[model samples]
Target: MPTSPTTVLIVGSGPTGLTLAIELARRAVDVRIIDKTPGFPRSSRAKGPNPRSLEVLEDLGVVGEVLAASSAPLPMRKYRNGVPIADAAPFADARPTPDAPYDRPRMIAQWRLEEILRARLAEYGVRVELGSELVGLAEGRTSVTAALAGGGEIEARYVAGCDGGHSAVRKLLGVPFEGKTDETQMMVCGDVEAEGPDRGFWHQWFDEDGAVMLCPIPGTRSGWWFQAGPETDASGAPVPPSLDSFRRLFAKHTRLPGSGLSDATLLSTYRVNERLAERYRVGRVFLAGDAAHVHSIAGGLGMNTGIQDAYNLGWKLARVASGRADPALLDTYEEERLPIAADALDLSAERLRATMEAIRKPGGGLDSAVSERTNGLGGGYRRSSLATGGGTGRLRAGDRAPDAPCRDLATGTPRRLFEAFAGPHFTLLGFGPGTAQALREAAGAHDGELRAYGVDVGGPHGLADDGGHARTAYGIGPDEDLLVLVRPDNHVALIIPPGDLGAVGAYLNGAALERA
Candidate 1:
């Protein structure tokens, strides 16, 4: 078969692949994405998107649409013997604030999230090619040739494997996926309709046998996600999940009448398995999302982590393919994200164990600490290559840059500090007047690779007299002046004081600066 040429090719149309395509398209990179599935699945696997995931979606300009379609501040209800025991809306106080407005997870079904992402991708005039599966991969010095199931081939400067756990790309690369599958804990999951309960709260019932969890499926009438411990036969063989099986399990565990439940769809039995690829990239072929790592479903971080992986790689891939930066810049993708995946694996596994243990202890509720952290807000890349050190009272790199309302000197319109951090560009934020010249010089030196913005240190639009939200976000004192360099990923790349202009230039020119 003849090889079709493209700048970048991505396999799988899941959140990870679609996010990569959207990011690359926003940067005007010519890219194509292929998936084996004919269309999106209607089942709700991942219940919601976390705060960190929301930030990434916000950058794609689809957070508003997602928010509108999502249900948030979901009250977690615990029931015993078909009677409500405790009901607590954990994030009832959560509101959208400047630093981290998405204080709680938005309970939107994974299918609906994909729909919103597809709509955003459509805005860039790109559609996912369905029924095209990756069958083979051959790499050369400059490009990768991928064989398609459609009896064709595609040649692209780079290929990313966003395909799920049983990734053919990972298999083709001959990398070892090391992990263990928990045979002890098996789950039967399906989407079903319940006539007796209102679709408002997520309910969990715990007893000596096991626990059954049910959460409302957002945007679906009478739809809910049902998960329960598996039932094994006399031979120890696992019973397959079906509508009848789900009905029976719910009736036995939660004591809810099974007759009221109907229309169970997409039933499947699964065992929680944790795994991570030994490597994220090999030559020109790369992996992201489930292809790279898989973990327990306790936190729902599996899909969110994959979305973040694509967000981190999208701009870097665009730059390298466009010949703007050195290909070595791609190495940082794994360096920054691999450890994060490792942390996520450990955290989720721990949460699963803790939740199980809690069920065994009397008067034990879900650990509030574990529940809050599992939401993905507390995860950070403090040890990434882009991070720099700081002492007490100093802003450090690798921390999320703070946002404050500021006026754009050019347009005289009020905007948040995050506005300057938008787009795939290096942003130099000046804390005072002197850094303006430094920013100008750096912009000239880096040319197309950097963008500079100046934030004055006076008045209502400037840093507050007492160093308020902006000060805390940027970690600057009211009297101190400095320049903060933010990467396209919205991470603080470097914090430069008055004398560090030259250092900033060298840093931008170094490998840390992504291509294009």
Candidate 2:
């Protein structure tokens, strides 16, 4: 509600908005974040961060806390007639690699993850403004004015609609959100305390009449995440989700007493609704997270995709907002994330169908949903305009910048490639000594925006690829002269011959600079 203009206005304080706010603030950009609710929701709603998201969290500097507070996904113990029949650990084989670390998803509650992000955001002297709802929005050529519920108005350079499903900002832009809702795939989910199952394994009881699943919440003693296949009447209409109905279904499916389940709060019903926005951007306003797309909850991709969307947009928004790059740089956010969301929609639906099929068979479980195969590691923007030169070397533009173990030339100690790429700056990893002068010159020309490092290159004190791991990971020979420009989000923005420094500058300039 301050009279001064904000650089970015983020609507919704969920994972999406929180991630964006942290990204912009860490870059020293002025950002304002708001949520409609008066207080933070405490529900253990979504499962937790996937493998790729853990990398994002590491970049954000909160993975240690997440790992301390969370646990790995537990094996699902299947039961028939209240007797244990099978144990399935789909993600057990997921392990860390030098290129892609943090192999599996953690099992923290959604509320706990948000709390950690909020604490990290506070380190930057910013806090979420709760109870502030957008009532009206006015957009102009280069700025947006958002009117809140309490007769307050805010002016921002850009408005990001991280608000979920029914987004007010998306509505103001009049963009169409298209998808289908399958009522037949209904579920009732909640957080509760039950006396039925051990805390080590996720318990699932299946019967001809009904089904119930109880998974222990990582940080709670008596608390468990409860999910149930909906109970139906003779006509097959789902009995509405309620306490008594949930109890009846649990008792009917399992041999455990109905009275054992208690404190069943934060209960809700969900139908499998798959939808994507027609477009992510409408002039000065952009939609992200569930605002831009919603998919079946299979594969645990719902919150993870939104977090990925925020990460992809955060660095671009910061660069453009800080005037280091052209606003056209922002267009690539949609170009990159929309296809990922569309593909995730299909992946989630396919996994959901497979899960349902498995539930009907003996020794069947949701292995496909929990596999690293469905994780977001394989996504990139190779086809975008920014990718050039046939993606030379083993690493190509539009591909993920792989990490490796190396030596700090200055200290003669072990270091990680990710350690150098940790902050909110573009990284240029140059191979061979001939590119050293250009790397240093480019770093000086861009000031602090671009950081340059020489790998296995001869200099007084340049980084040494002691094991040749960096060269192997980057797919470069010892004598090759390659310049790999890594975007702030750790994607290879441009992989060019060492002399093409102008190409790097032009890529950052974007169309916005030419128009100016």
Candidate 3:
């Protein structure tokens, strides 16, 4: 029998699916999220979210909880043949800017992060329907029908597959996952309990034969993440990961007793796989996160990329589902994200090669792999069709709208551009007097779909740039008049003259986002 219909059916309850569910639920869009697993796993595969992902969490109203549950990235304690050699702090000099609050990624177990997202989703009256598995998908003229493993079907206006690398949805879509898997390069990883290493730093052991790395997991008394070169038997075949094998590997690399390591769980083998799906969508069904793409885990991009993917697709899905935008708006999902995924594959591959090389040398460790590029702040959609009109100074259409501190004119309270951009509505910022009329017109025209604010122009919706950070961040001169339209995802959709109301209208119309 078919169940009640939902606006969107999210397959998989990992970070990706949870994010999409939160996005939709917050917008009052009916959403159902399911996971094949009976319950949440205890695994902590991916370390944590990056800076960009943190921003997404902030908009979703759960960044404070995440901050409380996570730890700052620790320094790396390196060893050679089991003797401590060097200490490296990759993010020692990293600091947050006025516009970017997070300078580096936090260190938290993947399971903990997922728990936070799930809790946030619950606040919006949505819960992960565990034990429900998606076995098949059928797209109709207006909705998608998903077949569950247990003799049930769910109908939804859209379906997003955020399932992992071996995604059933991708297979059902018959989309080719085109990429190579380097079997030779592999790592055995697990959550473990160990007695010896200090928890202050991420400890790494290097030797002629292999290496073992262990980082203490946050929110756990003795939990640690263990990763190492695969253990092989006399036949040179990799030994299957287990408590015994994990203990043996730890003892062999760190020269610690096997008895010191215990309670090994979530054991798995990781091979270098770089795969991207041929298409992100087929009819009303779509793919996100690992279902859409998979990459090497070098740059810590796997989970963060998925979080960002959900963030990108969330608002667009909400608008289209609510009939506020044309169905064609959904096409931009693949157009913008596919290219970014390709670039991420290349970046992670390059980072992997470099880190592997660095680990081979004396007194070198994974800390050397950290850099600004891995911060995930530079990505933009400048080449995207959604990036319309001309740019001013350093910022242009499709770039992330940077945050700036200011004062709200009505209440004279301190506020930030991010605060204005927060929520499911598109934001329009008008700089100087010339933009005031356009701001008023745009607000009157779009109503609930858009929020218009005037910067440095005193009015009901005016914001005073006390520190001048807003103008500088947007690259506007002291006396200039500019109008910047930001998408629901915080990316600039257009930058035009203050009085060019036609440009704003054209962009809004062309984007097919007018409220019905």
Candidate maximizing lDDT? 3
| Model 3 agreement with the true structure over 1-516: per-residue lDDT tens digits | 568898899999999999999999999999999999998997699999899999999999999999999999999999998899999998899888878989999989989999999989999999999999889888888888999997899999899999999999999999999999999899999999988689998999988789999999999989999999999999999999998988888899888898988989999999999999999999888899999888888889998889999999999899878887678888889888998888889999988888889888978888766778888888898887788668988899889999999999999899999999999999999999888888999999989889999999778989999999999899999999999999999999888887677777777666423311
Worst 10 residues of 2 by lDDT: 507-516
Best by TM-score: 3
Residues 39-137, candidate 1: write the lDDT tens digits.
777857877688888888887888899999998846777766666777766677667665665687778888888889989999999899998888999
Off by over 4 Å in 3: 511-516
TM-score of 1: 0.93
Q: What TM-score, computed on C-alpha atoms, does each candidate reach?
A: 0.93, 0.95, 0.97
The CA lDDT of each predicted structure is: 0.78, 0.85, 0.89
Please say which candidate is ahead in TM-score: 2 or 3.
Answer: 3
The per-prediction tally of clashing pairs is: 5, 0, 0
Q: Model 1 clash pairs?
A: 97-101, 319-515, 324-516, 325-515, 402-473
C-alpha RMSD for every candidate? 2.8, 2.1, 1.9
Q: How do the candidates rank by lDDT, highest first?
A: 3, 2, 1
- Provide the lowest-lDDT 10-residue window in model 1: 458-467
lDDT of 2 by residue, 1-516 (tens): 536589899999999899989999999999999999999999688889988888888899999999998999899998887788999887777778777777778899889999999999999998999999998888877788999988999899999999999899888888999999998778898888887478999888876656898889888888888889897889988887777777888888777778888888888988889999999998888999999999988899989999989999999888887787777877878888999999999889888888888878766666646545477888887876666643655778888788888888888988788888998988988888878887877788876788888887755436888888888888988778888889889988877777887777776667323422
